[model samples]
Target: MAKAMRTTPLGGTRQLRRWHRARILQAIRAEAGISRLRLARKLDLSPSVVTEAVAELLAEGLLVEKPLPPTGQGRPSVALDLEGECHGVLAWEIDLDRMAVALLNLRGEVRARAVLPPAPDSLSAALEQLQAATAPHLSGVRVLAAGLSIPGLLEPAQGHLTLAPNLGWADLPLLERFRAALEALGLNKTLAVVENEANAAAYGLYALGSLALEHCVYLSLGVGVGSGVVVKRSVYHGARFHAGEVGHISLDPQGPPCRCGKRGCAEAFLSLRRWQEAPTLARLGEMAERLAQLSAVVLATLDPERVVLGGPLVEATGEALLRLIQAKLPRYALSVHAPEQVALSPLGREAALLGVGALAADFFMEQMAYEEVS
Candidate 1:
């Protein structure tokens, strides 16, 4: 078993059912418009089992049977898809200076969104404000779950936020605090999850179809770095749910030291904080040599289909980074075609926020599927 932790009051049987439904929903989610036969095969479940689960999900308005388009062969097979408005997921995405809350439906549409000043470090006040921001849209929409995307590390299994390092908060009991907040708002939710900001952004990339390839590495160059990896269309959240912490990869053994107590991590070179610290680093062109050097190192190891460069600094110095990747990557990897491979994300600052919304909707849809099955 992979690090099991339950935050629900449901009995053992009910918890098993919930886990089963969530897996099924995730399989369907990986590929859109997949036939029932293929869905079962992908999940390695029996045809009867797939049919039963699909029937239950359809009843709960979580899955819809869509008409298959012509395939130039026999009659098109029936396909399964997520139904719009099946449920709503609320996201409270936190950053250094501000916070964003969004209510998203099952079909991944944003129905309502808001941004507010981040509450004081006290967890209670933050929860109260978020609950109120989310309450107005709850009627007629099933609220299956919500997720809190924080800038710092969260030990999701333990339900403990191991300090927002940038904000100087330490060892906060985040999940329990959130539970208290919801109870005060007259709400009993199915579940509330804690997701890393970069991981959420990576999830957003997939849920929105930015990736159409086998493997994608989502790299963020914000105040810090976070990586989200998609293997076979599902997130590979390592044994400890800490799979893609690529920002900490050491680039220079002798260079500046990271707050992680390590030297030469990518964030040490590419982050906005570093760029701002050096008044001479105002133009991307000035940092072109350094950005290219870092890009070459990242590309040589990951060789991702597209190296999504985004953050405040990526814009100011994108051209410079591209040039550096083009120059040093060829020298290191000996690949003549390396320059044009890395692509910047079309969805810049919005990437992380959008991901929070998607994960929330996914949590709700799967929860509903399990309830209907019971």
Candidate 2:
């Protein structure tokens, strides 16, 4: 006798539906031009569930389907991709020397970009410059949100920048100011997010799928040395949301003075200013050795898959410096960690801008999904 099989309905709760929608979008973004069947398989979701969620996304203009070429099969399939041309997020990186802005579409593509003059000394002047630089790009674009990456301690929860030594700014209400700037530009509905430049760069690398592993570290060497730690594809902000200040790690209590008012901190030894002053092989080797030492500490503590060296200094030095660091890392790191684990960033100076922009877009999409489900 044959046994009868029983099947349960695929109905899901609101939260589950929202999760499915978000996952579907993420999977599609990761593997752009993916087929619906492939998306369902990748996410381990029922075909009906994916179809329903995708239908909602399509109606909301968040996704689009492109027809695939005939393969001599029963029926041709359609590929899914983000509706990138219609929506975007504004991303900004405010450094001590300059500010860069970019418009990132839903597909994580930079549709437009511009580099503004150095940030002004006062907060009000900086805001005016930012508005002027950003307004020209937003004429016809639907901006979902904005992301700001600053080089210093950022209390994101409070929207405050506790300190930016290179810029000589402290206790600035960054988020409030940015929001006001957006409102003044007639974008009152857009959301804004602020993060440390190093953290944003790390997240940007993660979002770009540059590394296979979920955990990694980004060492940003610019006017100052900073590091961003990512664990499981998320930035690891410590108890006060100010983790990854690796620059302040006192390597030698009697070493050179750092801008952060600390002596012998890693930044004092490794800041780009110091390297630029003496761009010689011996100095490069010293910088690489010190960076390798710092990286070794990072590896032992976080045990990330790799430590990515980035920022203006690394871009200027290129692979020559990376080779030195790779050669020296093993001396301080554990036997299990290989020298090859240290690598150079491919994104260069644009890492923070792109990273924060992608984050802002993802946040907007997630919030939209939640609202629909709720």
Candidate 3:
């Protein structure tokens, strides 16, 4: 005779249920229009568990079921998708020359986006302009959180901009300012986050449909060159949150000086600002080769499954630069097999904003589960 299975507390069971629901919801967002049966197989949860969790999500208006045409199935398959217009996040990117604000849905799709003026003199000024610009599109929706991306090293935990040479900002308490602005705008309940622009863009590419690998590196080449490494489908911030400072990687001992006070750093040669200053075919090729060298270093160390080139420079050079990088990769890759393929980001300038949306969406989902279990 077998002993009876141990029973968990009623509250524990409800918590488990909420966790399962969160996972199912996440899968639905990742692979929009995924069937429950497929989600069960992918997430390795029992069909009954998925059914129960999905049912709850449907009731909560976070998910919707769409009927799929049968392909020799018993009943028409119902695919789960994030409910459009249910809720969204506010994502902002403050760069050297511009500030972009976007509203993204649960599936990381941009519902509305606005490119405001250049970086403002103060955080408050930027917030005021952003609020006025996005006011028309901000009504009738629950905003889960606000995410801000900046081109600088940041104390992310406190949302402080520690250093941004291009923008001439230092030790700016952006997160605190953002929270205060939200309170002033009567949006006190919305959470706020601040992150490095490159890291956010890398995470955005991973969370969005841009990359399909568990590990990939995103090279952001704007006023500077930085990298974001995604391991296990999450951004890998190093011990000091400077994991991918590829920009400062010294390339030439006697090369031009970088803002970080390094000579011959990759950013000194490959940055968009540098390219713009010396726009010539020869310079473009040199920059492209340097980019390839950076990619080689990434492959040699991190060995990610894919490498992505992004930021303002990539957009400017487009296919010409992409081909140069690809052509030069074989020489530097030093791999027995073909090197990891490098691709341009589909998210373009909006990558950071979408990335914040991805983070905010996940945070909001976890918040939902917490509220339910509590």
Candidate 1 local lDDT, 233-318, one digit each (tens): 45567786667777787777897888899998766766777677773634454355555555565566666665566655666566
Rank order by lDDT, top first?
2, 3, 1
User: Which is the leading candidate under TM-score?
Assistant: 2
In model 2, how large is the Cα lDDT of residue 96? 80
**How much is the lDDT of residue 195 in candidate 3?**
81
Ranking by TM-score: 2, 3, 1
- Mind giving the per-residue lDDT tens digits that candidate 2 earns over 243-269? 898888988899888766889889888
List of clashing residue pairs for candidate 2: none
Give the Cα lDDT of each candidate: 0.67, 0.83, 0.79
Deviating ranges (above 4 Å) for candidate 3 = 1-11, 34-52, 66-78, 337-340, 369-373
RMSD of each: 5.6, 5.9, 5.2
TM-score of every model versus the real structure: 0.73, 0.91, 0.88
For all candidates, the clash counts are 1, 0, 0
